[model samples]
Target: MPKTKTERVTISLCPPVDLGGEPGWIPFDAPSLVGESLRFVSGEPDGNRFRARYYRDAEQHLHARIWFGPETEGPPGHAHGGAVAAVMDEALGLAAWAAGYPIVVGNLNVSFRNMLPLQKVVTVESRVISAEGRKVMVHGRIFSGETVYAEAECLCITIPGK
Candidate 1:
């Protein structure tokens, strides 16, 4: 028997929903010196692929709530590894900035534990683990509740000026 084909549907990749104003969390405002040029997760507010909200805990660790939208899919319903890496990169890099270091990532190492489902809200937590001269090391994880999807380490260096 031949299967019937249905008409294709059109979909728009709209921006993710806001997850701000959670209890015991304070919003971390990124510096606007870069103006509108930066294009990653932290730079663009209307980014359709991924949506992230930066926050600081009482202990001052950098944490974020992220939504992996449909546009980031790579394997079936899961998010692309690059998309996941990009999120970790931005979150971990911002951790350095939040800790008062104006820097750029020198190297980013990401380990995928499990595939992340699209359109799901996940939490990213980061800490500045070590600092030596111009080097800053940050560790982070992407998880939903108790399920960890990925972990990353980002080494950042001071951006010479500012």
Candidate 2:
């Protein structure tokens, strides 16, 4: 038998800021509230797919600092629209949950503003805008500074009896 050489690959990741240390922001574990069902988009905190962390501000507004890895790329050097939508879906629904409404996303409408570049950490800010009966409306945007990548409106329906 002949001996073979092994190869190693190293990947550099750019994590988001430490929101837990930032004033007026409190970090949270999404899985604790929503269970492991949300692990798809936020499953791997330091993974090659997507890295996400959740926080709540002084006003109790849910915010997420997310990084889209190379595995999420669609158009050369950018993230896929589906990837963007997945983030919106998870973040918005989680927003409703954080607001004390146990719900599931009934409908989601996302408008693509600009193509998101991969490997960069972006902020997803979400808030429950209105709640009428079982309907909960959440508005959120994915942006980095002045660049708005996408905006989404999620209609969540409260789980029966929850």
Candidate 3:
């Protein structure tokens, strides 16, 4: 499969919205940031130039918004399947990390539901289902805007901290 070229975006995250429907300011990088938040996930492997920025949207929700350039093309104008899986793995793993457990993939099951266009933004969402001791189970979906492109389920186990 061909590689996917990605670009990072400069973000201006929105402030928190109050339950009372009023303006509430929550710092983007604050610990107790209510609602969704985004953290930096690394790009493609260091030696590779394809840049993919990942984000942790919440304690249980992880997101990856990707941009692949024209050079990275599959089927004329679609993203490669392997590229999509890689993004899913990274995003889902981070979701596990966000829930206070860093993990390895115990197992992963993915289904490619449709063709995903290249050079467009792709977003991934992951959520933790539950946990058993060091193992956390997760499920996620990849979207091309409002369209579903792929879905995945993963089991992750935390490694002991040094």
Candidate 4:
């Protein structure tokens, strides 16, 4: 028996299905969109204390875990506000992708609230709240061991070419 060109596949449904009744259709020979599979293929940086790990939750919200070490320290043993902002920005980018929106930061607005401690395992979380066409609104927070160091709100746009 020979396997036909036709294939059987599974697709995830979105809040509102746009591509017919299916959300994502996997073909026998190729991938339509670069989704979770792409994330795993291109994992986050490693071998550094100040590394960020990216993950996607069951609800499809983007999540990241990071650590800031001595190299990234400022003010003698404390993390810099700019460092905190960078972490938040990464999370925001992942959030856009998880929400079926792949985007580039158009305008990022970050607000600092407190100090972040260096050499501690900091965490960042983000998600997409709203979107229109290629434009999306992303929000995220940076935390130092349960204490919030900063928050962010970004206006981003998805470049359709991936």
Error of 4 at 111 (Å): 1.1
Model 3 lDDT per residue over 25-139, tens place:
2212222322232222233222121334445443425555555444455677787777677667766776777666757778888899988876565666678999988889999
Off by over 4 Å in 4: 1-49, 144-146
- Each model's TM-score? 0.84, 0.88, 0.64, 0.67
Model 2 stretches astray by more than 4 angstroms = 1-22
Worst 10 residues of 1 by lDDT: 30-39
Sort every candidate by TM-score, greatest first. 2, 1, 4, 3
TM-score of 3: 0.64
What is candidate 1's CA lDDT for residue 140?
99
Query: On a 0 to 100 scale, what is the lDDT of residue 44 in model 1?
Result: 49
| Candidate number achieving the greatest lDDT relative to the actual structure | 2
What lDDT tens digits, residue by residue, belong to model 2 across residues 74-142? 999999999999999999999999999999999999999999998888999999999999999999999
Itemize residue pairs with steric clashes in candidate 3.
none
Clashes of each: 0, 0, 0, 0
Candidate order by decreasing lDDT: 2, 1, 4, 3
Point out the higher-scoring one by lDDT: 2 or 3: 2
| Pairs clashing within candidate 4 | none
- Candidate 3 local Cα displacement, residue 62, angstroms: 2.0
